[model samples]
Target chain A: MSEVIVITSGKGGVGKTTTTANVGTGLAQLNKKVVLIDTDIGLRNLDVVMGLENRIVYNLVDVVEGNCRMKQALIKDKRYPNLSLLPSAQTRDKTAVSPEQMIKVIEELKEEYDYILLDCPAGIEQGFKNAIAGADRALVVTTPEVSAIRDADRIIGLLGANELKKVELIVNRLRMDMVKRGDMMNINDVTDILAIDLIGAVPDDEQIVISTNQGEPLVGSDCLAGKAFENICHRILGEDVPFLDLEIKTSIWDKIKEIFKKN
Target chain B: MSLMDLFKKKNSGDIAKDRLKLVLISDRANCSPDVMEMIKNDIIQVISKYMEIDAEGLDIQITQTESEGNNGNVPALYANIPIKDMKHTGPAR
Candidate 1:
């Protein structure tokens, strides 16, 4: 059976979609049959980020409503033959699909795929509930900002309330330069507040924006954050890989050397 | 000595004061290391019967101090309750 993982965050715009795209792509590149389900219905962007938006004729709602079969709604990724996408319905709301329906869908996909990724919507509403209902594990994404961390903590509390035990942290959109300047919170600072196991840290890369616009991820490239996502995927697959050094620890000497090098 | 040295010396004290303010705020607010007006309101509610406290001048804080053993420690909470300002209508008890 495929390991159903839900990528969610309490707050919006913290790179949930980007993390989903990268991790899902990374797992697919590893020759694992992966299916990503976008549960953000009516406000879907997972397909756009994955570069499979045009191929979405039948979506998650269609399958749930019995309008189409699950196989028909599942869009195949040309980049990775094993990667597929179950797109969200743009015309319907999240309530169109019940949690039990989602469980059934995941269970069916589990037989055919090695990994089933659920891209959850923002906020702790019905959409969030629907997205995490059938998942075996969850990845709580948060930025270093106070608001983002607070929302993540609230989500962690909610996850515990639901008896979901295997939860991990994914610190996204991290700015190393700002962290070094003490203008932003560090990883330890964030981890200390959340008090959870860390899975991955994706550095804030402008290249991500370019790649998203281009309808693909920067994963498999030498981009620092992309490499970190790949590492996270490997770790998820029970592979022991060294964590990326996304933390920028700059000393007085290092600063001076950088200044000297700039001249 | 350069003026930069003098400013550094002055800023060192300011930094300590700033850190003290932050630590106190964190303790009182139980959140980010910044003073919030909600803490002032809480202090007002606690001391309203005892004395007519100046909500604006009410200094509530947490002071985070360095420890030799631990790298980072939780800040200490300090609430300055003004006992002298308490109204004594009768003989002092």
Candidate 2:
């Protein structure tokens, strides 16, 4: 069965775009046909993250407004043959697309792709509603911070209220070093407060920044965040893969590097 | 305070959990305060059918409790209704 999922985080800058890029890429790596839709109209970033920014001839608004077909708006990724991205319109606002329009677009994409991942914009506004309209489930991405958790709790309630109750939590940017010092919230602290089934928890890693800077999804790479994204894909595929042990065994060199960075 | 006392002080993680527990209960039951009035009134009407009750003393609100899912916590509705007397009813009609 085809599943349409919206990756959302109520607060902005909590790795929503990065999660959408990596998860979609990971799914494609598993040989599933996946299409990522950037629902953050007026501010597009999925294209850059997927390294397909220059190929965006048409956008979500073009498809919705009947200016172009869905295929014309979808930009195929260079690396993944099964992966594509439907970039949102930069000139148009969120009001350009309605929930009904979004649902219609997703239904068409459903027949072509095994999974349709929507990169939802921040805040519970019109864009958020449009992104989630056609989604069968939700993957809420949040960091291990109080502010992010507060917004995530609100998003979960909003998701339930909107009848999209099949939701999973992805705790991102977890720093195990800080967690050991009792300075940062751990997996249990987040899940206990959120009261939702955790899908994956990505450890804080600098490689994520490098990959994003290069406009590359790190799922195929060898790193903590990359492996976490791969594990998330496995879980999404119903493979019952266990969560990665994100214990950061700090070596002498790592401790020295941290000291240098702090200095 | 001694150095041991500093270590014994509540860690930031526990403090965050404590604060979020209190915040989310109100946040989750965000429809309270306004909807609470309607709920309290409806409860009074229902309870008054079976017994004379102290509607003024009825206290109902949202609180947190231990959850079953991986030891996580969830918001629970805590209702405290004070009953004045039971209305005597004859056997089923």
- Chain A TM-score across all models, in listed order: 0.94, 0.95
lDDT of candidate 1 over A1-263, digit per residue (tens): 57999999889999899999999999998999999999999899999999998888999988988999898999999888999999999998878988899998888898999999999999999999998899889999999876687778778888887888999999998888877656677787778667788998889888899999999877878888879889989989988887777754366787899999999
lDDT of 2 by residue, A104-195 (tens): 99999999999999999999999999999999999999998999999999999999999988999999999998899998989999998898
lDDT value, residue A97 of candidate 2: 97
Error of 2 at B33 (Å): 6.8
RMSD of each: 5.9, 5.6
Candidate 1 residue pairs in clash (backbone atoms < 3 Å): B23-B62, B24-B61, B24-B62
The best candidate in terms of lDDT: 2
**Fraction of native Cα-Cα interface contacts (under 8 Å, chains A and B) also present in model 2:** 0.73
Residue B14 error, candidate 1, Å: 15
Chain A TM-score of model 2 comes to 0.95
Best by DockQ: 2
